[model samples]
Target: MTTNQRRAARFNKAFGNRLAGPLLSRMPGFGAVLHKGRRSGRVYRTPVKIFRTAGGFTMSLPYGPKSDWVRNVQAAGGCQLVSLGRRFDLVEPRVYHDREQRVIPRPLRPLLARFKAFDFIELRLAPAGAGRAER
Candidate 1:
């Protein structure tokens, strides 16, 4: 990889593990985790901001579909969610489209705008069972 790409990768890895993971765990409605691809089997942990919807918990991937975590979620159809020192299994993910992006709350628009450069994808995570550990 190019120097810049290498730098970004390094930064993402460290930030996800050391910073994002912990912070998301403390949030009221957040359910972030480290997920792996079932096919490629590559591992990556992403800090996802989740919103509760009528269907379930929808997590927007600001970085878009090209991101490793997004791709992994697609491949695995499921993932292990780590939060508040607990791990829970997530169900299959369904990708949402641009038109549907508008459904995202207005308050998060600025944060979502940061992904304008990428192909955005949203995944709804369903908790496998009741009383799943928080972190």
Candidate 2:
């Protein structure tokens, strides 16, 4: 990672769980969580903006395809989403293909464009009540 990338990662690691967690919960369209990679088993808890869609709650992987969290969610087939003091298990997350990219909402276009260097993934969560129990 570049120096700035490393620094950002460090900042995220430190403040993400402690400060970002509660802050994200207060945001109208955001959620935060720690997710474990099914294969590598590494875990990352970070902040994400979520929107209610026809299928379910959708969040964009703006950091792009190489992001460890994105890969982990893909491998694990789901992830843990925490918001407003509640946690839910997200399932069936899939990367956004070329055609699907055109449909990304305009409000999120800027955020998604920032990660243009990396491929984006759109994650859809399972129903609230159907989430797996927290460990």
Candidate 3:
């Protein structure tokens, strides 16, 4: 991460996480990635800009991979996400640098581009129509 990225991360943790995180997490198109702490086992909800993809969903990592939520999800191999008024069990975690951010909604692309958040968290959502137990 560059100096700017580091600064932004700090600011987000200090303010954004506490203030905007909860509200955004509940809204449509924006939601929370829920993960457990690597050691403490405490659950955490992180606000993220999420977009639906062909098979699943992609999240913009504005704070890059070093963010706590990103690390937690990666370490655990899977996590739950609440978005679009539904709960999804997301698995097969992968990280990538989506330079063009093609997965993001067109209207939001420019805003995300300004933050240079090319890092993305990709996960495969459980098959639709699966029974509650399957999900």
- Using TM-score as the measure, which candidate wins? 3
Q: State model 2's lDDT.
A: 0.65
For residue 64, give model 1's deviation from the true position in Å.
1.5
The candidate, 2 or 3, that scores higher on lDDT is 3
lDDT of 2 by residue, 10-42 (tens): 676677547766788667777775788667676
lDDT of 1 by residue, 1-135 (tens): 346655665687676556767777667657665677666666766776666566445676554455677667777676766655666656667775564366578776666665542234444445545324343
For model 3, the superposed segments whose C-alpha errors exceed 4 Å read: 127-135
User: All models: lDDT?
Assistant: 0.61, 0.65, 0.82
- What's the TM for model 2? 0.66
- Which residue pairs in candidate 2 collide? none
How many steric overlaps are in each model, in order?
5, 0, 0
* Candidate 3, position 15, lDDT: 86
Candidate 2 residues lying further than 4 Å off, grouped into runs, are 1-11, 14-18, 38-43, 97-104, 111-119, 127-135
lDDT for 54 (candidate 1):
64
